[model samples]
Target: MDLLTPDLGLFIWNLLAFLILFFILKKTAWKPILKSLNEREKGISDSLATAEKVKAEMAQLKSENEALLAKAREERAALLKEARDTKDKIINEAKDQAKLEAGKIITDARAAIEQQKMAAITEVKNQVGNLVIEVSEKILRRELSNKSEQEKYIKDLANEVKLN
Candidate 1:
């Protein structure tokens, strides 16, 4: 029972001592502690804001880079298409040139063959005519060995001509 109950005088003394100590601490430590807490909070808020800004800038840079990459791809595709077109044009031109050259070669070969054929035909005809003349001369020399015989054959040829 005595431990559970406090004396009036002791309660008054304890209250007085607590109030004095509270006032002393308030005057010495409260303002500095509050100011430090406030500064720390402000610094944290500023850092968070800066981080958010940097994140936004990174996102912007990423979008810009994507756009640039897309543009470069388009340019590359266009260049490839142009190169293909040029290559096709070159190939077609080469084919056309080759065709023309082949045609010209064929024409030249045909002309040369025709000229050779004509020359061979003329040479064969000349050779055949010369052979015929030589045969006729040998036959005439054998048959008309005597002048009297030749004169007799001439008279008979003239008589046949007169009958025709």
Candidate 2:
């Protein structure tokens, strides 16, 4: 029973001591504690704001990177297409040049063949002319050896000419 109920004077003294301690703490430490807490809250809010700004900038940079990548891809495709077109044009030109060269070669070969044929014909004509002269000399020498044979040959040649 005694432990449960305190003396009135002791209770009053304890109350007075608690009030004095509270006022002393309030006067000496309360303002600085509150100021420190406010400063910590402001620092946390500033850090959060800075983080949000960085995140936004990162998102913007990511979008810009994607745009640059797309542009690079387009440029690469264009370069490849141009290269393919240039390659095709070069191949076509080479084929055309080859065809022209072949045509020229064929023309040259035909000209050479024609020149050879003409030379062969002229040589054959010259050989025939020489053989005819030789044959005529032999025939005239044999026929003209006798006056009677020569007269007969001349009369025969005149008759052949009149028939023709």
Candidate 3:
């Protein structure tokens, strides 16, 4: 029974010690502990707020990047269309130039053929005139071959004149 029971003097001494320790701890440690707890709470709240702000910024950046990608795609399509149009125009122009060159070549060939035909016609006419002159000279040379034949012909012409 005595072991389980506190003595009166011991109780009074314990009460005094408890009162002193409470006062010392209240004076020295309470404010620092409460301030540290508040600072820790504030730090946690700031970190959470910063995280949320970063998440929002990241979302905005993602949206902006998607928009930029879309714009780049549109620009690329327009550039491709323009390049195709330019290529078609160049091809058409080249075809037109080729056609013009072919026409010029054909016209030049026709003119050259006409000039050759005219030259051949002139050569044939000159040859025919020479041949006619040669035939006439041969006939005239046969007719005037002998002086005795010319005298006999003159005597026959005189006899016919006297009979008439």
lDDT of 2 by residue, 1-164 (tens): 99999999999999999999999999999999999999999999999999999999999999999999999999999999999999999999999999999999999999999999999999988876776676576566674677888778766654544211
Q: TM-scores for all candidates?
A: 0.74, 0.77, 0.73
lDDT of 1 at 108: 100
Worst 10 residues of 3 by lDDT: 155-164
Q: What is the C-alpha RMSD of each candidate to the true structure, in Å?
A: 8.4, 7.2, 11.7
Candidate 2, residue 67: CA error in Å? 1.0
Model 3 error, position 79 (Å): 0.5
What tens digits encode model 3's per-residue C-alpha lDDT throughout 1-164? 99899999999999999999999999999899999999999999999999999999999999999999999999999999999999999999999999999999999999999999999888888776776576555545667568898667555544544311
Residue pairs of candidate 2 with colliding backbone atoms: none
Q: Which lDDT tens digits does candidate 1 get at residues 79-157?
A: 9999999999999999999999999999999999999999999998887677667655655766767899877766655
List the global CA lDDT of all models: 0.87, 0.88, 0.86
Cα-based lDDT at residue 123, candidate 1: 90
The Cα error of candidate 2 at residue 78, in Å, is 0.9
The candidate scoring highest on TM-score is: 2
